[model samples]
Target: MATTHADDPGRCPEPLSTPDDFMGGFCAFNFTSGPAAGSFCWDRQPDYSAYRESSFGHGILEVKNETYALWKWHRNQDLYQGAVGDEIYIVREPERCLLKSSIAAYF
Candidate 1:
């Protein structure tokens, strides 16, 4: 459910230095079930160590339904090619997923 949108207004396509220039595109993540099910724009960097690695790629998590989701990683170098990392139909139980409750209650 994530996608890169059109370029930002008045911003040059230069390297990212500050947080303001870090996010070049927009990504949308949708939740298909549970009480907090909804769509949201993930315009921020994740705390995951894998994402912090020195790499030029993007990841997407799409919730197909209540228990099924898809994850994809696209490298910047190979835009014309297919996704470098791809997985589908991942089973996620909302009630049993501890991270879900913790993150939901964090705020």
Candidate 2:
């Protein structure tokens, strides 16, 4: 099981970014802050040929706004499963444009 807190020590002071979406959007943090940091999010539908690696294991980025996007995996079931609820954030400065997940949604 997974659990999170309003005051978790590891939680970011503030989300790197937040956007409006179906899940009412979410709070995003630096990529290095999550367990799946530095990895690619692969999906199939609405394919992205430029980033496509294989048919079975590819991901797609559905940009929601300047600060958020949805990273869907190549699967038929729940698109928001796995990690970070299939949501991602854009981190500028210090991180310099790093795509990351939110602890609020992932943890």
The list of candidate 2 runs beyond 4 A from truth reads: 1-55, 76-107
Across residues 1-107, which tens digit of lDDT does each residue of candidate 1 receive? 34443222333233232234335553333445443245242233334434343246677888888878888877755757675655656886676666656654432
TM-score of each: 0.35, 0.23
lDDT of 2 by residue, 15-44 (tens): 425453754685443346244354222112
Candidate 2 clashes between residue pairs 3 or more apart in a chain or in different chains: 42-58, 42-59, 43-58, 43-59, 43-60
Worst 10 residues of 1 by lDDT: 6-15
Instruction: Give me the displacement of residue 12 in model 1, in angstroms.
Output: 11
Residue 45, model 1: Cα distance from true site in angstroms: 8.4
Q: After superposition, how far is residue 77 of candidate 1 from its true place, in Å?
A: 0.7
Return the lDDT, model 1, position 23: 52
